[model samples]
Target chain A: MKRLSEERTKLVFEKLTKYLGDNLKVLIDRPDGTYCFRERKDRVYYVSEKILSLASTVGSDHLVSLGTCFGKFTKSGKFRLHITALNYLAPHAQYKIWVKPSAEQQFLYGHHIAKSGLGRITENTPQYQGIVVFSMNDLPLGFGVTSKSTADCKHADPMSTICFHQADIGEYIRSEDTLL
Target chain B: MDVVNAILEKNVNSNKSISVHKDLELEIDEGTLLASDYNVFDKENLRSSQDTYLKNLTRDNVQVLINKIWMLQTERVDEAIVGILPKPVFVLPRARSVPKPKPLTKWQQFAKEKGITSKKKNKSKVTWDEELEKWIPKYGYKKAKADEQKEWLVEVNDPTKFTNGEDPFTASKTAKREKQAKNELQRLRNLAKAKNVKLPRVGIPSTEHFRDARQLAAATTIARASTASVGKFQSRLPKEKDAKDIASHVPGIKKKRKEAPLSVVQEKQRNKKLAESILRSKSTILHVDAPVPSTKSAKSSNSGGKKKSSKKEGKGAKKPKGGKGKRDLRSKVGGRKRR
Candidate 1:
């Protein structure tokens, strides 16, 4: 495993802050253990020192995976967070949207959330902001970027899309082979 | 009391290395020695009267130790009877690792295999000299020997060999030397055998002969790639048969693609610093690129640097603490007012 370069770290940090915001500090300066971001095979893993040191014993090429794959760098060199990071991101999400029961299935099927399905949205959530989508019962089902701001959602039509679909929990089954 | 009458109190801070102390000071030094007790006391048993309990325990233990020592067989030596101490009672914990068996020298290994026991040196430093008829050192200065002698002149039997008038003393001393050549040869042999550092071969010479295995491999690989046919048709060259060494002076080749270095520490600090700077810029759009922080603009408006710093602190105080806590309270009050 290797550390992210300054330029690469900047890209990863900027994307991470979009979802976690101020809670990003908890990941780096964790009390439970020292954690860091390591890049292996173009994928960044949020690994603790103990796990990383142990994993380092295995040859980089032969080692299949590392501790908690956070995201990967696209072919165009842009950083994208994967669905596997939902467990960590959900707890620290700055802006969140709770989906209605009727639309939870549709969201799981990888469809953009509509205004009618938006059970509740955090106030002042800016447009294009990264947000975690949860069910009305508080189960985090998926996450995506917002299409419209909180203020604009009130005047918009019920059928108009409010949240753009990026990834959902269903990917665990659909893309299980390629997740890591 | 007699020294106190003649003492000068003003000279207390004198810089002399040795100083005389009062009788009371010596007593205090000896009193602190009792703090290092070898016996253990059950703190709970002696909870009320520790000092008296410790005193009794120490006295009884010392008496038992003395009785044990006196029971041992005594020996008279140096005009006194002394008890022969037995093996220690307490086994202290080891403060260091087990001593490793030393690597055997060649002679020791040979002797062990041949079942040749070594003979101890004679304890006497002096040996009887036949020529001098007196005792002389066994090894050092002025040792008695029949062949090696300190004489004024040397008589050479072969006059033809000494026609060039060479120094016969050095020649005779070398001949008299015992195992000098054998010792040097064994030392070099041990050095080469330990790591198999190949000795320079006969017939040809090059600096590449001394290079390590890794460097030699890389150099050979580099040489093969640089040739006309790319070393495909080239026959395997004999190691002993020296060929033209290409890149013999070059140490190593530079890597084309450098991997991202492994320093989790630097990455952690760098990522944190970048994120903090980004977070700060998000709320307050300060001109980071602006030279000297627009205290220049403040300097134009204000007269002194002191006022500028105070004004900057005032600006900081005016900003809300956070986006959620205090801002939510302020927004709630504003919403109520608008209603």
Candidate 2:
């Protein structure tokens, strides 16, 4: 396989830095033909072999996939986090909602979670902002959009809906399987 | 002379006509004609006449007399023609006529009578206030309220609410960062909770043990050696070669071979042949005119000359060999060039 050119590597780095952060370190291996990333704290993450191979099929206009989650690098050089990317970003992310097992199933099935099923909601989460959803076991379920403000969520009824699920593994699988 | 006397006798009988001739004779006798004055006369002989009576009659008075006689003859002819010919008939020009305007439609007529210009009214315009940092309606309270409500509805899903000045990508980045920070805090809290609470361990052990056939054989051999002999069966016995040799016999061993160096003469000859071959290949590909390098001195001299000539040429013009010009000619002749 041909290795990425210096210009392409620089473009990828710029995009990743904008989306991920300024502290991200991207390394390209010419011999092995692999891409790897390290955060500010020196935690290294490798681009999945599957995604690396998929890079060949991607068009010139397509965004680069950074990690296993295939978090896309937009044309504007910002990273749009996919649900799979949450596994890598969960540790460093700010707001998270721990859902009940039932709610987790519902969330993966592409249904929004109600306030009652939420085990915990982080403080100061703004309304309509992007958020990460996790299961009871601490596995990142998916990403979601907050439907209510932090203050509103506090005073609202227990059954009131909190977040609208954005992306999940179940949705990805459904999209991939033609038989469905 | 008889004709002249007849004309004079006829003029004397008409006293009114004779009165005009008498006035002409009086006007002519007032001026004394000169020789220079004769130049103004149309007839050459009349201008050079020495008779004083004719001299007193200037060219102007003679012309007036001729005009009066011509006018009298023309007037008599016109009068006789008018008596015989029929009168001409004239037609007067008529004024242009215009068509009446079409009757207006019922709605148009009603609108005209009511003095209503248009059916729809001008909507209230809204402008952004720099001081207040919000959009304000130019009209009344109702319009302002409506604008506010519309703004509120749009603001709900507005991604730029928090990141107004930033681009869409940067705005999304800020949102993602905010989300990540929240998740990290929650994770830390969960980690604390797990530390404080005593949770039961679940699932199978992470590490696994496997027994290989070779490992089993080696273990048995080691056990038998320990039981049978203390110092007899060593890993590397004195009778055996090194472990590498044993590994080589096992299979998949790559042994490194040392290459032998060529003699000076052979090396020189080989290098010369290689260089000649390279030059030949290059000449074939590029169609260079220079001969192949058989000897070092000849090659060096040729290259030096070529460099000097190339420098003199600077950037040479490209020759269109086997190109459009040649192809067009070959096509016209219906013949292909040999490769």
Candidate 3:
């Protein structure tokens, strides 16, 4: 698959915006090591330790980078960002999000991995390819893309995100469905 | 010894018939005495019921013979004591008690006379009376005309279902009786009221409240005569409201009034009236035909000054000429003599 461009990411964001009505949040990690979050207009923004920790992982520099990225993606739509719950609660991101694609948008297979900020890291890494999937952690122990297209992108290193690939995503989604 | 076989059989009997009866009673005494010193009979005594000497002897006699043998050997009695004894005697077993017959009850006798044995159970059979439309007892109904049955068929089912539903039929009968009673009571009430006889109070606590024919007639008469009929027809009213409204409608019965609230002027006037009344009673009020003032005039009258002067004069009049001799009657009523 080709790298997700800014335009393509916007289309994905736009599709995800539908689910934002259904209480899902969207987030992105920038190359500068900072993070940005997306929210529904009706919902109040709450910065919990979890989002703060995720932002810490991207660092303040990456946060600024993610802000620019998100700004470019969401040209017209508005959203609020919150950095909640530092370190102790970053991995729960996948289950809390339920993205609704527009009737025309295809249901992206690895779209959920983006919520945990792993996709940003994996898409930028030289060793990654295709779409990276995130599981329970930001560590490289999980599965990720192993294609040259994803590796050669001009984005920051995505090794941390790529490690959490499809298998991890499958495990997390199975557990969540079981809980339901 | 010389004669030897002389005359041996000189006279051998001409003809002889021989019959032998064994009367056995063995008595052994081997010098050293012991109760079981020797054996007499090897087996149990033989038993016979008829009278051949052996037949005459019972098993008990045989047992006695064995005990004698032991006794003779152990006690060493004289031969004469042994010889005097006849054949052995044996034990006789105890007889069993006879069983008594049970007496039959009258019902059982009637059952039998009808050829109905206790062992034979009679099942109920119901026959349809076409004319009156009821199932009648099959056997009993045979004597009665089909047109005479007055009962109507309420239900019909298989014998099993019929027997199981006996209790429900009984319940229906009781409820029917109750409904009949209620209808009769309503009928009686209507007739009594039409004749202007009071309908006795239906739900009162006293026993007379029961609306029997006589009481109903009496109550109706009373109500018709008195204007008290205003509260009589309350069958349509809700119970609580009817009871409350009925009391008020009863004529010539006055409800007690609540105490009046007195205004300041009225209160002062009342006090003044009470004081004057109290003063007058002490003097002019005690005189015969004094004509007590009405409540209104008493309030305006000033009797206080005149009452005091009159009281002094009254005291002087009351004093006897021989002052201390007579007891004062007025003093007995209101003076120091009244405890």
Candidate 4:
């Protein structure tokens, strides 16, 4: 079995965040049914995961939901978290992500969790962690492995996609079902 | 009556300097005061109307004042007239009249009375004679008769033949007249020989000798001088040219050339530039500024604006003061046009 290292996961997310720095206003949607986006004051504009998720809803089966994330998150405002997400969609795992405020709940969870006496996540000292959730109906509960994906690099936030090597997941949890 | 008598009698002995009276007016020379009047009109009795001299003067006194005014106007008082006045009187001395004769002397009187004329006469006299065609001898020769005639005949006749004449004039070389005739014949024979010309035996005077002796002598001198100059010039002339050229080379002679000297290009250019410069200067002095196009445009715009504004205002319109009217206003307002 292989487990994903925190350093390797963070490196993948950092490469995606670099594209989304100053020019773009990005949006994301979380699985918990919350929407997140940044809007400009002068121009009417919107970018969101609902728009991104349309790619999947249209029966684009090649779209992968790696259910992994990694990147920087900052609590710079009340009820506001600036998450620089480096996410991946699959079957061809193209990194499409942005660094901006996340979907409403995602932003609240990231912002509230970081500011509630959590360890400092600065530029020099960044958080590197991830979660990999398996399908509960397809697997027997407590029988399937639910080991979180981790990488040692830096900047892990809630919606930041953390990609893992299939062999590394084998190192942490043995999966009897075929790899999706 | 007493005042009248007093004024009439006016002590002519008392005021010796004042002279002449007319229109019952005492015409005093400019400075004499009416002392008698002044004495009667003195300050203590100044207001005594009936008896006082000032009261007695009446309108008659104004004549003297008028005369004084006239004298003041016409005569400029000077120091000489001032010196003539009495001690108390303030005489305004007048400018002197033009000078007159200082009375005649005895000699002038005698001359004037006698009516004398100058004795000196102009002695010069003019005379004319028609037959002689010149003035004949006057006082001097008229008396010296036959002797003078003999000398005149001797001068007019040929020097070689005077034997027909005997009483030879005293004015001539009388003692040597015969000797002169012989010498003249010999001289004429020698002259013929020297010139290689034939001699006439009965020697006659040259026609030139009949002319005035002085004229003949002058002609001979002029001929001699001309001949000498011809010889000298002939010897000095260039051998290359003929007598025609020599004649042309006569002293003081000048020849005219066919063409004048060519002018330098720079000189022509300079003259052209000078002419152009004068033209430019003349034009510049008279150059009036061209009427401004902008003003014309503004004028047209103003007319248009007035028309449009009138249309907007409807019917009862005011015409703009412009064009000739503006010019008239400018002149009337005494504002000089800027241009």
TM-score of chain A of 3: 0.19
* Model 2 pairs in collision: A19-A79, A93-B180, A93-B181, A93-B184, A94-B180, A94-B181, A94-B182, A94-B183, A95-B182, A95-B183
Candidate 4: tens digits of C-alpha lDDT, residues B1-339: 999788878876445432323344344444454422221334555555545545435333555554454555343376333223334455556689767755554445567899965565864433454544555444455534533443454443555644445444542456557667877876666566556778543555577454765555444333333664543443332433222233344432234444443223332343334334443543332222112134344344434333321222110112112233344443422112234
Q: Tell me each candidate's RMSD, in Å, in order.
A: 29.1, 44.8, 44.2, 50.6
Model 1 regions more than 4 Å off: B1-262, B284-339
Question: Residue by residue across B169-271, what tens digits does model 1's lDDT show?
Answer: 7666665574678778778867775666776566653665746655566556666556665555545566722133433543343234655664667666777
**How many clashes in each candidate?**
0, 10, 42, 28
For residue A114, give model 3's deviation from the true position in Å: 99
Candidates 2 and 3 compared: the better one by lDDT is 2
Which tens-of-lDDT digit does each residue in B1-339 have in candidate 3? 546555444434422212222355334232322122133433334323234434433333544444544444232366444323333343335497665544444455568788886564776587676765677766554534442334334454446445555664565567769988987876666566546687544464455573575554444444543654554553432332212233355453336665566533443344334434433453342242133334223222323222332222111112211122114534311111122
**What TM-score goes with each of the models?**
0.40, 0.25, 0.15, 0.11
Clashes of 1: 0
Residues B85-166 of candidate 2 have per-residue lDDT tens digits of 2232333254766656655544556789999787558754777766556677777666546545554433334554654554
* Candidates' C-alpha lDDT: 0.66, 0.48, 0.34, 0.32
Candidate 4, residue A84: the lDDT equals: 13
Against the native complex, each candidate's DockQ, computed on alpha carbons, is 0.08, 0.01, 0.00, 0.00
Candidate 2: fnat, from 0 to 1? 0.00
Which is the leading candidate under DockQ? 1
TM-score of 1: 0.40
Tell me which of candidates 1 and 2 scores higher on lDDT.
1
lDDT of 4: 0.32
